[model samples]
Target chain A: MLAIVVLLVIWWVAYWLKLQPPHLLPSPLDVWGTFTKLLTNGAVWEAVTKSLQRAFLGFAISVVLGTLLGLALAQFTLFRRAFGPLITGLQILPSIAWVPAAILWFSISTEAMLFVVILGATPSIANGLASGIAQMPSIYPRVGKMLGATGFDAIRFVILPAALPGYIAGLRQGWAFAWRSLMAAELIAYAPALGIGLGQVLQQGRELVDMPMVMTAIILILFVGILVELCIFAPLERYVLKQRGLAGAKR
Target chain B: MSESTIVPDSSPRAVAERSGLHVPESLIDAATAVSINRVSKSFGNDLNPDGSLRAPVLKEISLDVRQGEFVCLLGASGCGKSTLLNLIAGLDSPTQGTIETPGGRTALMFQESALFPWLTAGDNIKLALRLADVPKAEWNDEIERLLELVHLGGQGSKRIHELSGGMRQRVALARALAQRSKILLMDEPFAALDAITRDVLHEELSRIWQEQDLTIIFVTHNVREAVRLGQRVMLMSSRPGTFVRQWDVDVTGERRIEAPEIAALASEITTDLRREIRRHAK
Candidate 1:
């Protein structure tokens, strides 16, 4: 309550002082008004839905590719020797760094944005899976073999389940990468054929010097990020960890 | 019972014939459930280029377990008791010699429960059954029966973390039993529990062994545990582990851990084990 009150006080003081003029630094209330206006006109819903669809499509591909890559890296020594360092290097490379190549290949279209999202997320997901497999207790495989589990049956019944915690953590990180990469791609490449998203809204607001619109887009991005994490990833992770008795009581 | 009365049978064939009573023809191979023929195990690549210096972890050892027999391998920490158990479980191969088990599959239980954290107690048993090629249709009934056999019964839905240490070991026992193997190899399964809990588990194990008519090869560093559980206890020496001594415990009726005969036998083994350790120091 105190933090909110302090923030409100700062907002009101800034408006009253007319800091940096109304057009450049719009009051918090003006930003709120813009958000309500966007909601009433359905612009916010349209932009959010389009962005979510692209994010989901790209992420789905990443999940399949990443998990397979991770399994290969863990199971085969040749794959580990070949691509392990390259995968780490890709993870460290910023999502925005892929934008130039993505645009060059796909010509600033939805395909280009998707390319960026997949590149941004795949390495983290694969690396997460690899590390999880690597950290699994050696006793598990021996136990599996004693039970007569062999080859793919061992991988399915023993290895995959044992490495789930790390895999899920990787996916969470991958989602973050996918979202940021999508936004970066949107800001850089203005493909009129592709629908407007929050990133595009922010970019348009900058060109028009519409401060309230820029703030509105920023708030929406933050809200979506928090919402997805809380609704999907957090609960999924907690349930899995708790079932394994890896988690303590929730606060 | 004196130390001298507990004699080592150098020839296991004679011992098996003497102990062979209830063993079935199909179940027993030449009246023995397991035959360890001059077995030896070593770690790392070929030891000492010269063949004279043999530092194998387990040296040429020969022993036999009669069908439905309860045998304990007792020694100090580095005695390769676990190594011997692993060789029997087929988890590792002996460097020399052969271990023959005519009874087909064998189940191994570790000191730690080794239960998959992701699986419930029932599911863990079910997985064991599935891996052992038990038909899917019988899994539900078999799972319930196995749980009840371990005294778990309706607690099948409970996760591994929900179980106490003794309960987890019971669940592990149920999982091993799910293999439907004639032999059960336990590596100090009760070593992690409290004294009270260990005592309870010992009774449970003895009861289960009798009920199932299972051949058990239990490995432990504890002397009293061996006396309380095993009909015969085999002691091993540590450095280049070798089967050094054996004691055939002849106790009528169900022997409790605190009984006078059990205590007397345990003390004798403890003295021998201490002497073995002392020899290592020299």
Candidate 2:
């Protein structure tokens, strides 16, 4: 994109002019050299695989928990009145804020990392489903009852399908928060037992004051985020919107 | 076609009847399908000084829908016609008194198709069939039969969005039929359609009504639509809606939406409806 071109040009200018110092602003080529060296040393693959595996596991748990929470909050009036505000409050609280407590309780382990990721992603996912259920057209429930669908049957067949589009969008947002929280956990809770992940790579670069290595890690993080958006969220949303015929229902 | 005769698949239904598929012997009347005895509905809590409820929508409404009868409830915009229909459909209960549809559950068709977009036409009917306790093995055949009844045969595979507006309504009708309930309540089911489509659907509905032996309670503001379809049209007054008048439509020939007899009766009903509306202005 033109924005990438502009960014590359600015970086080249800063590096060429030695705006700060040779140590601070490395050329794009230098960053590329460091990226290739990491790839050849197998650190890039090792870090990517470990980080992504954690992301997958954490996200899977959050989705299951979030969906249950969303349904409970949406269906049971007593449950919603009790826990809805509390869950929403949890959403606004930053995942990074949990790092210290998590480190203490989990002692710089995978548990510490997963604890933060699950906490970060679950609320957004739940809220997504809650909002989706709330925004469902009134006709669905009424019709569901007319056809003898009561309680759980109504929730499963009518409410769930009607809330699907919103649920999917929630899933995408949950994934975003999940990835970010995982990275933050990695950066803060780096240790030998945790293995060499992207966050650990960035932390190592920071300790060594290696500019090119830091840039490579940041680019990889952004790359994964963009890749998920393009490969998963975009197509899923398009399919749902198209199949539902967004314009047909009044909403 | 009489109840005593054994149709080809009557054995299963016979067994189902014994197993309480239809309403029990004591509760069900052979002639009447739905019995609404002095039923009333209201919205909101009782905040009045005398402890009367706030905003009564239907006031002491009474009606009996006989087996295979086609009755239409005609009224102005603010009338509790839809609220009454909802009460009858069991979507909502009467705030006072009771409504008894002793012929098992009823199916209601809304103005919009209200079909699940994620489902194909067949699947929509399948849900209704499933809820109605139709056997799983017979689902494919039942769906085909119902779709065919609505003149939508072999089109069950199509997505709801792929169908035309008229087709969607037909699919909705098929879904309602799939419920296998003796009663079908429609609340302005074709109000959103074009004139031509509406007219065509009316004819199809009349044919389906007789063919399927359904007792229908159709609600609408359109008087001509009521005249064109109902065997008996009940005109309701708005604002605490109650039946003000009733006309037994007995045209001796084919009834069209714009037939002279229909127009004449509709105009008479319109005059009364206008008077009811005028009363609100004061």
| Each model's iRMS | 0.7, 1.0
Instruction: List model 2 lDDT by residue over A138-180, tens digit each.
Output: 8898889888899889988998889999899889999999999
> How many residue pairs clash per model?
0, 0
How much lDDT does each candidate structure score?
0.87, 0.86
DockQ of each: 0.80, 0.67
For model 1 chain B, the run of ten residues with the poorest summed lDDT: B1-10
Off by over 4 Å in 1: A1-19, B1-11, B14-30, B51-54
TM-score for chain B in model 2: 0.86
Would you list the clashing residue pairs of candidate 1? none
Mind listing the fnat for each candidate? Answer: 0.88, 0.78
DockQ of 1: 0.80
Minimum summed lDDT over a 10-residue window in model 1 chain A is located at: A189-198
After TM-score superposition, what is the CA distance of residue A128 in candidate 1 from its true location, in Å?
Answer: 2.0
Model 1 docking category: high
lDDT of 2 by residue, B101-136 (tens): 876678899999799998899999999999989999
